[model samples]
Target: MSDQPVNLVSVNTAPERAKKVIGTVIENVKDKYTIVHAGNSATIDGVKPLLLSIQPPPGILFCASMWTPEEQAEIQQIARETIPGIRTHAIPTGLQVQVGPDGVIKYLMERIDDIMKV
Candidate 1:
């Protein structure tokens, strides 16, 4: 697969845990993908333009917050308006793992791997 960038959007207040999880996740995927730890933003609008400007755009976006179906659809719609063919996947409540650092890292690795396969 082409080495399209992988964007990770994480927002955590805990320094130590965030460092460990984000650090580990970056280390694990850096060799194979161009990992952009897009950092937290006060609003998506603040980062949207930058993300949309990426050369090939990011192939996958791993969000730390779980959005409800309606919210997920809204985000997907907004993204599709800008980039056709983009898709969004939400992790259900039962399988969230946790909305913490670990969950974000886990989801990033798993989903990116799955997307890379396709």
Candidate 2:
């Protein structure tokens, strides 16, 4: 089997516009991406299960949260502390980030077209 890095896109609490952008990304990359719906919960308890449920797991985890700034920080902190090994990114709600297999961000953008370009 090929060992290409798995791309993860987590939608924590997306607004309407953010949802559309996420949808576009998913539609474009679904064949090679793992999508996680995190809803409004940001705690480890809430996110861990979803991560575990993904068969074979992912080499990279991208968490996108549309919550308030305070909540966003809390979520990012929890994810970093709880999940080890794999790469993790706590992206803002309206923005998107493409993470490479080496745990580095390849691209970050607010527009769907820019995200798709990655």
Candidate 3:
């Protein structure tokens, strides 16, 4: 409340409310410090899209991103064993993926038969 201006930005530490939000980030994000919060609605709005993006999907193709590690053998194993005519390519890290080429195309194409059988 002083008339003299003071830099209060660093004065505050992340509180218990912010602490609670860390649990909600995904397994990947939990390894880093990326939580965002404000004391109000604008803060919540800023973070909504990120939370939505991390939500797990219902099937194989759902795991696609621009790229994930080449070492997610479990997902690949499930795709190969359970789905037909599906193959995976392991592109190197940080190379751009092709447009009009769905990264998870193999998985998506295989989903039709599984979905129909279900």
Which candidate's TM-score is highest?
A: 1
Q: Evaluate all candidate structures by whole-model CA lDDT and list the values in order.
A: 0.52, 0.46, 0.28
For 1-118, candidate 1 gives per-residue lDDT tens digits of 3466665443223334444665677788777766665554233453356447655654444333444566545554555576555444444433344555566667767875665453
TM-score of 1: 0.57
Clashing pairs in 3: none
Better of 1 and 2 by TM-score: 1
What is the alpha-carbon lDDT for the whole of candidate 1?
A: 0.52
- Give me the displacement of residue 65 in model 2, in angstroms: 4.5
Give the TM-scores of the predictions, in the order they appear. 0.57, 0.46, 0.22
C-alpha RMSD by candidate, in order = 4.3, 8.2, 19.8
- The predicted structure with the larger TM-score, 2 or 3, is 2
Candidate 2 regions off by >4 Å? 5-9, 14-20, 26-45, 93-118
What RMSD does model 2 have?
8.2
Candidate 3: which stretches are off by over 4 Å?
Answer: 1-66, 70-72, 97-118
Question: For model 2, how does the per-residue alpha-carbon lDDT over 15-93 read when each residue is reduced to its tens digit?
Answer: 4434454455555555654443233333435766656656555444445544556665665555555555545555554
Position 112, candidate 1: lDDT: 59
